[model samples]
Target: MFYLPALLISGVPLKEKIVLRKLTTLTMLLWLPLTAQAFCGFYVAKADTSLYNQASQVVIVRKEDKTVLSLMNDYQGDLKDFALVIPVPQVLQQGQIHIGDAKLFEHLDNFSAPRLVEYHDQDPCQPMVAYAMAPGSDAMTKYKSDRIADRKGLGVTVEAEYTVGEYDIVILSAKESDGLETWLTSNGYKIPPGASVALEPYIKQGLKFFVAKVNLAEQSKTQLKFLRPLQFAFESPKFMLPIRLGMINAKGPQELIVYALTEKGRVEANNYQTIKLPSNLDIPVFVKNEFSDFYKAMFDVQVNKHKLSAVFTEYFWNMGWCDPCAAEPLAPAELKQLGVFWLSPEQFSGAGLPVQITRMHLRYTADSFPEDLMFQETGDTQNFQGRYVLRHPWQGKPEQCEAAQTYFKQLHERHVQEAKTLAELTGWDLANIRQKMDLKDQSSTQTQDKQWWKSLW
Candidate 1:
C-alpha cells in the first residue's frame, strides 16, 4: 500500500474551498498512475521523488468532456493499470511548453561563413564602357554656363571605337569643339608648329586618334608555356607575328571582338589582319587551371582567319643544392625532381611572329644546409647574368656577342675560390671536391649555353 502526505490546509477560508478542491483533484490525477502500478505488482522505486520519471509514458485528457488521462510506468506489461481522469480548464490547451536551454540557437548562428555569388554571361564580346573626368577640366556648373554663348547651342557626345592588330588603335569623335580640342592637346595629340594644316578638317570635326602596335606571335597561349622557357622557331614563309591578346570577347560562337588600341594608346579598328591555321595539324596546348573556363569560352572563335597557330609547349627549370668546392654546379637530377615553376603568359615568352628575344634575364639562388661547405659559401652570390647572341648560321665569327669572354673568365675565378673555401670548412679533400663540382658545373653550363644559330641545310 502507498501512503499519501497529509494536506496542510489549516486556516483556509470557506470561500476558497472550490480552489482547494481543484488543487486536490489535480494532485490526485498526477498520482493515479503510480497508485495503479503499485496494485499491479509494479514497484514505485525511487532514490529521490524530486526526479521526475520522464521515461514513463504520459497522456493528457480534458476532464470536463469526460476524456480519459492514462499515464504509464517505465515497465509496461500484460497487467492492466487504472486510468486517471482529472478536470482541467479548457484554457490549458492553448499554452505551449518549452524544454532545454535557450543558448543553443546563438551557437548555430556564429558558425556560418560569408557566401560569394559569381556572375557570368555566355556572350564574351560584351563591350566595356567607362566615363572618366577629364584631368584639368573644371566641373561644369550652371554659374559658368553663360561664359560662352555656344554652350546653349553646343551638344556633344564622345564615341570611341577599337580594333585588333599589331597594336591597339582607337578613334575618338565628338560634335562639340571645346571638349574635343581640350582632350586632344592634353592627351599629346597636338599638331607640330608650322606643319601643314591638312589634318585641320579632321581635328575641327572634333576627332582624336591614338595607335599602339605589338608583336602577337610571341605570347604564350596555353599552360605549357607557363611551365618553362619556350624556344620559338619562326619557319613561316611570310613574316607572321604572334600577338598577345588581352580582354578578348566572344560576342558569338563565330565572332571574336578584341579591343585594338593604337601606339598612342587610342582605340581604333579600321584595319584588321585575319589568318587561318591549318585544320589538319593538331598542336598540344596547356593553360593554367584558373584560366580553363576563359579559354573554353574562346575556343570556338575562328582561328583560321587569324592565320596563326597557337601551340602550348612544356617548359621547366630546376635548382638544387650546389657545392662550390665540388667540380660541378648542383641542379635537379631530372626535370621531374626539380622544383617546377610556372609563369603567366606575359612572362613566358615574347609576342609576335618571328619572335626575337632582344633581352633575356635569369637569376639563380642556391642554399646548402651545413653539410656541404662549398654550397654554403656560394649562397651569398645571388645574381649571375648571361645573355644569348644570335648570329646567322654561316657567319665564321658572329658579329653579335653577349658579355665578353673576360666576363666569363671572371665568373669562373669566383666559382673556384668559393669552392676552395667550402672544401676547407667541410674537411673534404680539395682534389675530390674540385672534380665533383667541376662536372656538375659543366653540365649546367652546357645546358644553358646559347650559341649562334646553326642551319640544318
Candidate 2:
C-alpha cells in the first residue's frame, strides 16, 4: 500500500531573475510542417498515467540551474495519515513553495501520452493524398518546549515553516538518519519501518528534508475533494530525482511517469539505460477496441525485457505542435502554470513557448533502481512517440479492378505481419490475435478479407 512518494527535492532559485533567451531548433521548424502534410491518421486512444493504479506522476520544469518540481498525490487514505518527506539540496523558503493546479498535470499527461492512431487505407485505384494534422492540503502542529530542546539535542533544525495553500510545510536539516527518523516519528509523522535506511543516503549527502502534512481546516475552505499537487522552485546544478524514499513501504513495483519540460530537445536518465519504447508499428485494426489492454500488456513485456531497470521514453516532442497530436498542444499560459518560468508575458498572447517535453515511464523497485534518477538534456531534436498504427483495409471488392486484386493480395501479407507484430509486442497468443482478425492462418491471407464489399459500380 504505497502512498504518494517523496519523488522530488533539490535546487536553488535564481536570485537575479535571469531572463531565459528563447532558442528554437531551426531543423525542428523546417520538419514541423512536414508532419501535418505527411501522416494522415486520427488519434483514437491514449495510454495515460491513469492506466496504472499505483503510478505517481511528477512534472519537472528545468532550465540551467533553475527547477520547478511538482508532485501529484494519489493517496487514498485518511487525510491525516497522508505525509510527504523529501530531501532537498537546500532549504526551500516560503516564497519557493507553491500549490499547483491538478488540471495542468492532467493536461500534460494527456498531451504526451502514448497514442493509438488509425489511418484508413487509401483506395488502390486512386492516387494517395496528403492530409494534416491534429493537436492536497495538510496541517501541522508545533513542538512543545521540551520537544524543541530534544530536537536540538538530536541535531535536527527546522530551517523554515510555512502554510502554503492547504499544506503545512517544514524544512528540516538533520545530522543523522536515525535521529531524523526518530524526530519525525516523535513529531507525529508515521515513519515507515525501513525509512531510516532510505533516509541515510540523502542525509549523508547533506540534503535537507522537506516535509508536508494536510491542514484539514485550510483544505475545507477550498471545497475540493482531492488534494492538489505541491510544487517548489529552486536552483541547483544537479539534475536528478530522489525516488529511493518512495520504495520503502511500497507493496510491490511502483509506476512512475516523469513529464520533463526543458528548453532543449529531450531528457534521458544519465545513469540508466534510457531506451524508446517500441513505436510506430502497424497493428491489427482490432487493437482500436482494446488499446488499453494492449498497451498495458506491451508495457509489461518491456518491463521484463529490460529487467525493470531501464527508463522508457514514451514521447519526446516540441510543445508547439504534435505530429499526430494526442491532445492539442499546450497553450503558453498553461505552460507557465506548469512552471515554464522563462516564458515572457508577451509570449503568452502569441504563439507557444520554445519548450520541449520528454515523457519517461518506469516500473521500479528498490533493488532494481538503486540510485536516484539522474537526468541530462540532449540536443536531439528528432521527434519520437510510442504511436501504434491501425490501417483499416479498403472495403472495395477484390475483383473490382486489377489494382484491387493486388491490394487484397498484399493486404493478406500485411495482416499476417500485423498479427506477428502484435504477438511480439504484447506477448499475447498469436492464434488469439489471428482469431480476432478472422485470419485463418498466416499461410492463407486471401481467404480472410476484412470487410465484405460485394462490388463497386
Candidate 3:
C-alpha cells in the first residue's frame, strides 16, 4: 500500500504519534487503488515552457488512437514562465491531444507538416489530439507498438488534438484536392464534412493579404527639373580651381549639364575696355534616369598638354621660396648705424635639386654666425661682407656610410611592401611598377610615404 510520504523525527513522541495515525488511515483508504489500478490505462498531458511564456503556443497529440481530449488557450500566464507537468487522466485507456497557439503551430508547419493538422480551416483554432501515455505510466515499454507512422509524401493526412483552456480541439490535415471524407478516414478521425465547425471570422481576418498598395505621392517631390547651363573657369597656367556650374531650385530626377569654358575677352565698343569672356563652349546635357547611370555618364575633361604643363610650372614656382643672401640691406639708417642690418641673397643657380636642401642650412644656422664673419672694414667705414657656404662632402667611414645606405634601402623596401599590402587590400594597383599611381595630392603622397617609412622598425 502506497500513500504520499510523511516525515517522522526521533525523540518527538507526540508528533510521531499523530503522523502514525494519519499514515494508517491513508493506507486503509487509498492503498487499494494504488496497488490494483496500476494496470489501468490513462493518457498524460505535458506542457512546455514555450506554452508557458507568451512567446509561442503549443499543441499536444496522442501518438496512437487519435482522440481529442482538451484545449488550453492563452496558456501564457503573467510570469511568462512555463513548466512541463504530465496530467494523468482518470480514464487511463483514453487517448488525447494538445494544441499550441496559432504562432507556434504555423512555425511548426515549416519543420514537419504531416505532424500538425488544422481544424475548421482556422489557423489558431482548436488543435486536434491523439493517443499519448499516462503520467509515470511506463507506456514507453508496455505500449511500444502504438507509435504513429512516418509517411513521406508531398502531403499526408494526420489527426491532431490540442487542449486550450478547457476546450477540446480536433483537426485533420490532408492535401488540398482531397475531400474531407478521405482525409478523416486516412487519419482515423472521421467527422463528416457537414458536421465540421465553420472557420472563425478572426482567423480569416488574420490571414495576410499577399498584395499591398504603395503610395506614389511621397516620390513626387523627388522629380527633378533641368535649368540653364552655368559657366565658370579654371584659370590658365594655374588650374587649381575647378570649373563650377551653379544650379538653383533643383529637385529630383537629377540631370547633368557639362559645358567647357573657352577663355575670351569682352570688349566695350565706346570705351575700348576689354573684359574677359568665355566662348565656343561645347556642352553635353542629359537627364539621369537611374542612380548607377548618372555616375557612369560623368567623364573628366583633361586640359590640353600645353595648358597642363604651364599650370604645373606656375603652381611649382608659387610654392618655391628661397632666401637670397646677396640682396642689399633694406633696414632704416638708425638700424644700419647700430649694426643690426641683415641681407638675403637675391639669386640661386640650381635646377632639379630638391628644395628642402636649400632651406635647411640657413634655417638651422641663421642666428649662430659670428659678427666678424658678416662685417669687414673698408678704410674708415664698415661694409657688409657676409659669406655663405654650403658643404655636404661625405667624410665618414665606409662602413658607416654603408649602414646609412642599408637603412635607406630597407626603408625603400618597406615602402614597397606597404604599397603591395595596400594594393592587395583595396584591389587598387597602388605600386605596380608598370602603372602610374594616382595620388590624391602632394600632401597625401608625403603622408603615405612617411607612414610606410616609419613601419620599417
lDDT of 3 by residue, 182-202 (tens): 333343432223211211111
TM-score per prediction, in order, is 0.13, 0.82, 0.13
Distance (Å) between predicted and true CA of 61, model 1? 79
- Write one digit per residue (lDDT tens) for candidate 2, span 243-267: 8777766656767788999997799
State each model's C-alpha RMSD to the native: 44.2, 14.8, 47.0
Residue range 285-368, candidate 1, lDDT tens digits: 111111222122222232322222221101001122211111111121211111111222233221211111010100101111
TM-score: model 3 vs. ground truth: 0.13
The worst-scoring run of ten residues by lDDT in candidate 3 lies at 357-366
lDDT of 2: 0.71
Each model's C-alpha lDDT? 0.20, 0.71, 0.19
lDDT of model 3, residue 439: 22
| Candidate order, lDDT descending | 2, 1, 3
Mark the regions of model 3 whose C-alpha exceeds 4 Å error after superposition.
1-213, 218-407, 426-457
